[model samples]
Target: MYSRRDERNRHGRDLTFSLLTPEDAFELLAFETAERAWFEQHIEARKEQFYSSHGVSQHIIDCLALNAQGRMSPLLIRHKGVLIGRANLRDIDGENASIGYRLAACACGQGIAQKALKHLMKEARCMYGLETLTAVVSVENQASRRVLEKAGFDAVDKLPDHARVADRRLDCLVYRCVLRQEVECA
Candidate 1:
């Protein structure tokens, strides 16, 4: 339900976001290809990436389909028409929303994650009337946690033994960004 008009109200559209649609699948697929390759090389064998045969490619396709059905908003990160990664706002709960993202490993450390998150936050606030957004990061994923912090999400809680990663119970850190605080900053 996020709107470009809300983005205009906060700032200009260029500084905010553009919603993703099913028509953007090809570009999204490109990023997914890169991400899946990176995961297979570095994360899969280590059991860090817990994806099935459906893979990132298929998962992206599914996300796009869901977006088209108004079930989610999955935005691909693009710079000059080149896809770098993807971020999504899902698990909607009335005024609250949950977010998650993945990037090609080569694209990491470039601030794209933070940029995508900032854009999504604005969209959620304006379009969905969302007051709170949350991100769940693996306890050991310092890099992802840092990205969330950079996007103005603060560690709000910790879910102990919340996920099974690589067959081992792992903790999860919950980070939250409240729209009221962001509006105050503006």
Candidate 2:
């Protein structure tokens, strides 16, 4: 039921969630390059080579491979024909997966991440047959924590000194959400 660039979920009307594809390499590269510092503030930084065309292509290929094997789900976020961010479901084991997202600086504080995340939760329940979704956020990232809270994730645990950001070690919080899909009658 998902299309190339028109996938819409119930969270909001302005955001589009589409499966990641090889065709998005360059645009994805630009978005990532522009938001590199912003992203590294809260999460791990990508290697320098990952900013290049070949690196992105290889990354897409590798992600698609995992998608084909039912091990990962990578999504691209768009707003009115512009690439804005990426939301991903990785480490997918039966009934469980880890979720993460990065938003462009311009897109942050605009409720786009919350909507994208809720849309991702729906995809997890309906498309991937996943029951539990977990997210890890750095303690200093209050915006992301608020977004997750608004999207129905509850703080479950904290990992001490689990992440390093801006040359300093920081604690990370683990958030979890359970989905209850409705059963359809035959």
Candidate 3:
């Protein structure tokens, strides 16, 4: 039931999501090493930054472990052969998809998120037959909110007291983008 055209149509244009493989460990490890050091010196001293505050948990380790086992696909963001960040197209729902990303602090403000998000969105529509994409962003994280907004996601609601950044409660913003609408507009 699948032909070359079908596969192409299902997976979308030439824009492919470069999958993360164990082979990527070297580059990922390098980025993480550099980031952890940078965080300790700069961002960590200030009220605990995003990646620094939570760091990586056993849950993430387990998830990556499962992903390495081929249970999921994680798209990596690489520039000039360097691992800059990663995003996962988790929880695909027939016509909708949810994704999460973590970028190297050094890669911030470089529009990497935008490029990654846009690529995923396009892939979701063309390949996954998805109509919408969603993401939950911490309200205090204005940079991420801006990135989503720049990618045409609309903040639909304010989830109050939904997250705890330490002892203080933090709100979360629910952002969504209609993939079909974007494609049609494009």
Candidate 4:
């Protein structure tokens, strides 16, 4: 379990980061439901079932299982004790992992997501021993692409028609970052 509780002050707002737990189901559900349309603009939409209590509980359970097995680090971003966003490192295989994050529309334009991402990268290096990280963003999501680039990720590839959001088919941009330089062997 990622048992650390971290507090960060951004623009006079208190931001908290921690591992997702079963206790987070209710708040997560509310956050997801409230921001579903906003999120679908850049990412795929969740099934209607995902807004339910049981569905969210199951989602939390599955994520925690992955966390315990060292395959993922699913985190919650809270502001003033409410679920404001999510940042996670997924598919942690060997020395590589992919990152994904989302923030409520109200949280946009404040650099909060970028800050949380940098913190996740720190945990990726120190706690998980990850050396490389990759991220994907919709080509239309200029905001997210900017965040990834601002955090030092380089655009490594592009996929045509990679994802569908609402009624539109969108392309995706793949980004990569090297967390550390590997030592040369004698």
Question: What are the TM-scores, per candidate, against the unseen true structure?
Answer: 0.69, 0.89, 0.67, 0.90
What root-mean-square deviation over C-alphas does model 2 reach? Answer: 5.6
Whole-model alpha-carbon lDDT for candidate 4: 0.87
- Considering only N, C-alpha and C atoms within 3 Å, which residue pairs clash in candidate 2? none
lDDT of 4 by residue, 60-105 (tens): 9999999999999999998778788999999999899999999999
**Backbone clashes, each candidate:** 1, 0, 1, 0
Using alpha carbons, what is the TM-score of model 1?
A: 0.69
Residue 118 accuracy (lDDT) in model 3 = 77
Q: What are the Cα lDDT values of the candidates?
A: 0.67, 0.85, 0.66, 0.87
Identify the leading candidate in terms of TM-score. Answer: 4
What tens digits encode model 3's per-residue C-alpha lDDT throughout 1-186? 987656534433322347765455555556666666543332212232223313333334555776555444478776655667777776776777787777778666656667678777877777677888888877878887888998889999888877655446677888998875546323
List candidate 1 segments past 4 Å from native: 1-18, 23-27, 37-71, 181-186
Better of 2 and 4 by TM-score: 4
Please list the Cα RMSD from the true structure of every candidate, rounded to 1 decimal place: 7.9, 5.6, 9.8, 6.5
Ranking by lDDT: 4, 2, 1, 3
Residue-level lDDT tens digits of model 2 in 39-98: 887788888899999999999999999999998999999887788899999989989999
User: Which model is ahead, 3 or 4, in terms of lDDT?
Assistant: 4
Give the worst 10-residue stretch by lDDT in candidate 3: 41-50
Better of 1 and 3 by TM-score: 1
Candidate with the larger lDDT of 2 and 4: 4
